[model samples]
Target: MELSCKVNYALLALLELARHRERGKLVQIEQIAADYQIPDRYLAQLLMTLRRCGIVRSQRGAKGGYLLAREPGQITLLEVFTCLEGTWSHKQESQAASLTQAHFAIEEIWQEATMAATAVLQRYTLEDLRQKRDEGQQFNPMYYI
Candidate 1:
């Protein structure tokens, strides 16, 4: 599946938060931008979107910044993606199908693909992802290894 730049940015922002979750520190947007090499202006807008969705909370005044609204364990990638990118929709049958084909068949295929993706995404929480990252584990292994 193709991901929009906004979605990529959102995920990167979350990963940065996840990495720092153990410290319970609120991260400044500029810090996240600098660390991830993201543009500060762009990152600000994206962070605002995240804030509006309640995925993140912002603070004002000195020593203030942003923090995850919920525990990392309570957040799912799909929830993040959905909040940032909305639901995934398959191509319309009119775009490339036999007009005679049953609607149920097309819907079934879409549902199956959505279900498979959902299963994988649901299995991972932000903290779970952090654990995987900390372990330096790859979900897929090299055939030669």
Candidate 2:
């Protein structure tokens, strides 16, 4: 149930890209790292993996940076999760006769939890997350004012 640092950082970086998608501007890694307080080098590696997965496109040179390969609405949380975390596996090594009824019950719980989590993640896109982010920030004081 725990998310790895790679997954978390990738999501944060993606969210920044999603937010700036409308501007159609390439966002630099330094900006993303600074905004999210993630290590610059670590973020670069994560973005490279995401770029390979076709979730993002990278450009080089002065006006170069990174951009989303597709619209945020088309990018689901599940896609991000799988891209960074890989596929989930429930298999564990065990002997056939080593199972108890309590063990069976616990495994059933795990199965249900995994299914529910997957379904929830698959239902939300980056656009949905953006909306939620904006909504959550509505009550914050405007420092620029």
Which residue runs does candidate 1 get wrong by more than 4 Å? 91-98, 102-107, 137-145
**Model 2: CA > 4 A from native:** 141-145
> lDDT at 137 for candidate 1?
60
TM-score of 2: 0.90
Query: How big is the positional error of residue 140 in model 2, measured in Å on the Cα after superposition?
Result: 1.8
Estimate the TM-score of every prediction: 0.79, 0.90
Give the alpha carbon lDDT tens digit for every residue of 1-145 in model 2.
Answer: 8888788889889999998889998999999989989999999999998999999999999989999999999999999999888877676467758978877888898899999989999999999988998998997876873
lDDT agreement of model 1 with the native: 0.81
lDDT of 1 by residue, 17-108 (tens): 87666798888889999988899999989888888988888888788888888888998888877887888777554645545467668778
* Per-model CA lDDT versus the true structure: 0.81, 0.90
lDDT of model 2, residue 85? 83
